[model samples]
Target: MASTGDTVQNLPVEEAVARGGVTEIEKGARDSTDELRHYQSSDFASLRDEIHKEITSRDVLLRKLEESVTRLSEDIAPVKDYVMAEMEEEDDDASSSSSDTPEDGAPQDGDQETEEERNIRALNRCVDVMMSLTEIRENNEEKTKKVRGFYEKIYKASPLTSLMLKFLERNGGVKVIIDCDSKDISNLVRGLANLDGEKCAGTTLHKFADFFECKVYLGGEAGKYQVWEGLKWVDKYHDPEASLSQSLAQMVMYLIFKNRGFPYKCDDDQCEKLYEKIAQEALQKMTSGAYMDYLINDALSMKTPLGREVSLISVVPGMLVKHGSQGGMRTLQEQVPFLTYFFMQHVIPKMRSIIN
Candidate 1:
């Protein structure tokens, strides 16, 4: 070994370098790279834990969404079912009516009804109207009209002629008189009542004389007194002297009397009774089917001059019927069908326009 090593050393550096000088250095570099490529068990465990966490989070979110959807479906299901049942009943009724013509050409009774049964049916119809009232309040104008029509149909079909009489009496403490017999009041002089003329001292007086069975001027001390008396009667509607139509007339007068200007031409002094006169005028305007616009045009414009800006819907909070207030009962529009009908038709349509 000494001889061979000594001979190689002496042989010259260039001839020895040609054989395999850097093989060990190359082997050491390859071994270090192989060591670094090995993955540890702890790293694999950490990656698995992260994946599990993400899977659990996704599962929780999915479950929460499903629960929310389930709750919403549950809430709507009953309403859907009730509406379907009502539609089916109506269809059945329509089919039976068309198919069942009696032998004498008269409509046959689907079933014989007793007195108690008729009463019960009428009660059901009233309940249906009550339900539809809430429905109309919740729905939009287009849908509300359909719901209201259902209630109207029910009311028209009912045999109860004096429905408003008892309802007004119980809720509004007012009486409903079909034909009020007030004496002739047109021939009476304005001076006799000390009523304000068109050129009154404080506010110009508008002649409501023809509007009533008698002559009465609005926008004066007497008109205020009448309003007070009317409110008193209405607030205590159960009293022996409560008149629904009179109370409503007072409320309407109170709302618009301040905008005094002119009056509509009445046929005659006693042509139409007070309540009938007011209702007929309202009915005539209702033909256009927009109560608020009718009031703005027919009531406000007819009552006041063009420059006056009087709004019936928008008023001071004090104007709303509250406890000890002189205007009306707190819920005047709800109890009196006249007010209720007009208010809903106006307010609902206004709300829809605003939303759009």
Candidate 2:
């Protein structure tokens, strides 16, 4: 109100009044906005720090979990390996044990049978052997008995008949006598005869020769015949180198004489008697070199009648000859066929019969 300048100043005041408190209000609002922005920035910084810490903690936890997992795997791996190895070892041991076992469940291959089982097997074998032996013996005995009975019947029926005539007639006839005491005759006869007597004789000779050949030469009940004491005396006194024919003749004569009962002729007074003087001459001839030569040629050639190809030299006789060289000449004769046959047929059979 005083001048222009004062008027300008007043105008300004008036304008300010008109805007009412707009400028002050605007400034206050601006200051408050700035303060809010600053506060918001600080809050955001705190939030970011907290988030970083949380992330760092999470990372640490993850690392620890990984380490724990690694440690657990490491611990379990050895245990797993050990368990597997143990299982493998157990399997190996079981397999080995199974392989080593025997079929009988024993641990050794040489497992033996029980004693009772062995004894049972042995007993069975013994029974089998004994049964076989018994059968053989029974058959042999039956054959022997039949042969003996047939011979005894023949001998008893006609004691005085000629052997040849007896052989020709089947019924109530004389049986051929086998002088088994004559080794030379026996050997020659046995060589010629067959077991069945088929090839030994024929119709030309009459069935007598065949029958006689079988009974005397071949194996038969002739083995059961007893040599007369007279025939034995003839054998004891016969010539060493005598022919088989001569020896056989002597045997026949002895048999005839024995049957007739050698009788001495006497006078009516009975003061003087003349006895047959045949024995002394026969005894002188037996020990000569001729008899030894005959025995060597004939007796040594005899073979077993059983059809085995064995020679007398290959048999027990040969063994006896080898061992018995030191025995006396008389002892040797006793070992010959005649004595052997007598013992084997008569003495042994009687002894066996008694025992049975």
Best by lDDT: 1
The residue pairs found clashing in candidate 2 are 166-174, 181-338, 240-290, 240-291, 241-290, 241-291
Assess every candidate by TM-score.
Answer: 0.20, 0.19
Ten consecutive residues with minimal summed lDDT in candidate 2? 271-280
Across 76-154, the per-residue lDDT of candidate 2 in tens digits comes to 3443343334334434544445544455665553323332333333333323332232211124555544433333332
Off by over 4 Å in 2: 1-23, 66-76, 82-86, 89-356
Per-residue lDDT tens digits for candidate 1, residues 1-356, read 57754654443444435774545556677787666654545677788899999889756744553454334324334433433343345345444444454545564465333323444454455445444323121245564454334333333321111132113212332211111111111222233221222332212222232223322222211112121332473121111011212223332322223222111113424312322333444445545554432122322333332211212221111122121121232232322233223332322232223222
lDDT of 1 at 45: 75
TM-score of 2: 0.19
Per-model lDDT:
0.32, 0.31
Stretches of candidate 1 off by over 4 Å are 1-167, 175-297, 302-342, 345-356
Question: Model 1: which residue pairs collide?
Answer: 173-237
